[model samples]
Target chain A: MILNDLSELAARIPDGAKIAIPPSRSGVAIAATHALIARNARGLHIVAIPTSGMQADMLIGAGAVQVMESAGVTLDEQGQAGRFVAAVKAGAIRLMDSTCPALISGLQAAEKGVPFLPMRGLIGSDLLKNRPDYKVVDNPMADGPDPIVLLPAIQPDIALFHAPLADRRGNVWIGKARELMTMAHAAHTTLVTVEEITEGDLMADPLRAPATIPAMYITAIARARGGAMPLALEGVYEADSAALAAYANAARTAEGFAAWLADAPGIAAA
Target chain B: MEYLPEELLICTITRLLEGTGHIAVGVSSPIPGSAALLTRALSNGKTGVTVLNSANLQTLNDGAGELFDRAAQGRIGAFFLSGGQIDGQANINLVGVGQYPQQDVRWSGSFGSAMLYYLVPRVILFREEHTRRTMVDQVDFISAPGTSPPEVYRPGGPYALVTGLGLFHFDKLRARFRLTSIHPGHSLEEILDNTGFGFDYEGEIPITPTPEPDRLSLLRGPIAAEIADPYPKFAAAIFKS
Candidate 1:
């Protein structure tokens, strides 16, 4: 289904929904995120595709997140994610600290419809001890005693992201961001905001089909021009460093963050 | 013929990455990314360089999971990792300080370090900050352990540690870092004073070699322009003439 506006898409993501979002470098649904915050959405469980950045920070700062599971959350060159740090320090949100591959493995298991997937590493690391769900067991194939970590499948309630293009049929052209496909496959529903909605079919073209996610996986699509502002969309545009730097500076304090959020272009209007 | 400290670090890192096949650099790593690009430039494109999140640099098509998959297959030769607190045993703590869940300080979670540290053949532990607070006797949490048990399926671990003060190689068998060379302006006393963890050092530690004139020219020239794509601020600040 095609949503009329960003808010309509945001409205689909109910409070306490387990939503999977891509990393900052990948296409991030910043506009949709703003809309969600504007609607005062709460108790969101964010599952970062391995890792995340400003989008996650903003959501956490807005008190929209109850749980955050990821390998890391950083602002890249901008500096530390102040809001996330503050939240973690305050014990505001439950953090499921995981390694990058472990998250991917869990998601892959869900995509493959498996109960769990066995992975190497994480033997003596503290991450294993902290995570009760991850179990270390002897590999049955090994002649000797070989220990490996088993990760349970992670199936999110929704997969949300932004992309460069999508068709009227809800097929999304992700280009090189294949992780979105993994997220879409691992989630119960996938929502996307795109720069433009083409009239024709995106999957019909041979060249574009390879990089396009079929509409079957996508639950809804919303046309959001420049949706990934402040964050880059790979081939579409470069990241606005000055804006990101401003956000980084303003998000340092709760008051500053609130002020910044209120003054943000779309949030006030929303 | 003068060079910046970043250039020196890049040169040192480039030398360490001399014979490695494909070098993969993580996010927020300008110095290592520059060095990997430099190594590739020096090798005339023989060495593969994959800088995560760079449109121009990344060659992977299968997305984020491919990097880990390649590492598991032993395709990635070298990788870089850093920590909030590194111990004598080379255990890195990217999680936070104090206790596990409720900690006083929290840096970014353990990125790909846990797997990459174990998968990548040569994992260079890089931290620009060298202090007692950053380097500890034992980490509050082991994000990625320095060494695994003998029966564990581990092929890669910490190869060396590079800081602003000096360079130290990790002895995995002994599970300790040995002081290899101190940077030109730094001293053994300074290192000993600043470091919270103990290390092995023999007789007189040699000063780390500065970047030669040719290497400096390359760093200030094509390499600087190339690195500007991913880390424009760093390139502009360091290479601004």
Candidate 2:
């Protein structure tokens, strides 16, 4: 399906759906985030692959998130993610504290259509203690008695992201950020926002074909120029440092964040 | 020569990685990243360095997944991790400062720390703060346990805990920390008074050796430029070359 607008795309995601979003440096659908916040979408289970930045904070700030599973949420060079920090401290949401590789392995299991995948590391971590879903079993292949932790596959209801280019056929050129492909593979549906739609066929070009996600995986697409605003889009643009600094300063408290969100660009328009 | 606190910490970490083959530094760790780069430069480019989110150093094309695969395969030699709270047993608490679900204070959650801490042969735990609240008797939560049980298939674990005050080596067999050396201008009494946990050390603790002039010059010069891309603020604040 093709979405004419951002709101229409955001509307497709049902409340309380388990959603997987890409990491911060990787393209995040910020325009979609704005639309979701405008719609006042609630009870989203946000699964961040490894870690997140402002996108997670904004969702938590809007009270759109119920359960967040991530390795960490920070603003990177901007310091701590204040909204996420406040939410956790206030016990406003359930947190599935995870390590980086565990999240990747979980998604990999889903991508491979496996029930569970045993991974190296996390054998003696408290991450194992907290996650009852994870199991430490004897390594059957080991010569000596050895233990390994098994992680349950993470099959989310939807995968959301921003891309630089896509075609009418729904094929997306993700460049080197291949984690988006993994997320799409592990989720039931994928919704994308792009800066521009490439003419003809993206799969036609030999160089682009290798990095393009074929039309089969994408559920819907929307044109959102500067979609990942404030956050950089790699070659498209650099991160708006001033705007992010302003947001970081304001997002320290609920009241400050609401006030800032009220005047936020796409959010205010929505 | 006068030195900044960050410079001292970077030098200390560089010393820890004297013979390291490859070092992978995660995001937001400017000091450790710089140290790794410094070590690589000192080793005549023999040591491989990977700094995530960096324009030049990070060579992985498959994102964090590739890094994990490499670490699991024993390609990465050293790594760095820090937490909101660290205990006498070297347990790190990256989740929060209070009971789970209803934490009083929350820093960022644990990232690839536990995974890398287990896979990287030399995992150095570094935190700028060395107060009682941070160096707790018992961590509020354990994001990554410092030691594993005898039956666990663990090839790597914590090698040392470095703070602004001093350095402590982790004895995996004993599952405890041993005071190694105190940094210049920091007293052992001060460390003991600020620390909430107990540690063992034989004889008098020695002072941490200062960085050589050539090494210091290298850090402030070429290494500073190398680190500027990923850690501009840190490079600007500390490097004086």
Instruction: Give each model's clash number.
Output: 0, 0
Candidate 2: C-alpha RMSD after superposition: 1.7
The residue-level lDDT of candidate 1 at A102 comes to 91
Question: Best by DockQ, which number?
Answer: 1
Alpha carbon deviation, residue A159, candidate 2 (Å): 0.4
- What's the true lDDT of residue B31 in model 1? 97
Off by over 4 Å in 2: A267-270
lDDT per residue as tens, model 1, B148-199: 8899888999999999999999999999999999998999999999999999
lDDT (Cα, tens digit) per residue for candidate 2, span A1-270: 568899988898999999999887789899899999999999999999878889999999999999999998988778889999898888788989898888989999999999999987776566777789999888889898887888999999999999999998899998878888898888999999998897779999899988888889999999888899889886678789898898899999899999988887773212
Model 1: per-residue lDDT, tens digit, A1-270? 888888889889999999999988679999999999988999999999989999999999999999999999999888889999999999999999999899989999999999999987888899999899999999999899999999999999999999999998889999999999899999999999988888989899999999999999999998888888899998999899899999999889998899999898883112
Candidate 1 residue B11 C-alpha distance from true site, Å: 1.6
Every model's DockQ, to 2 decimals?
0.85, 0.76
Cα lDDT for residue B129, candidate 2: 93
Question: lDDT of each model, Cα atoms only?
Answer: 0.91, 0.88
Candidate 2 residue-wise lDDT, B1-241, digit = tens: 7777788889999999988999999888998998999999989778999998877787888865999899999999999989789998888988887778678888788888778777889999999899998999998888888887878657888898999999999999888899999999999999999999888888999999887778888899999999998877778888742
Q: Best candidate per lDDT, number?
A: 1
TM-score of each: 0.97, 0.97
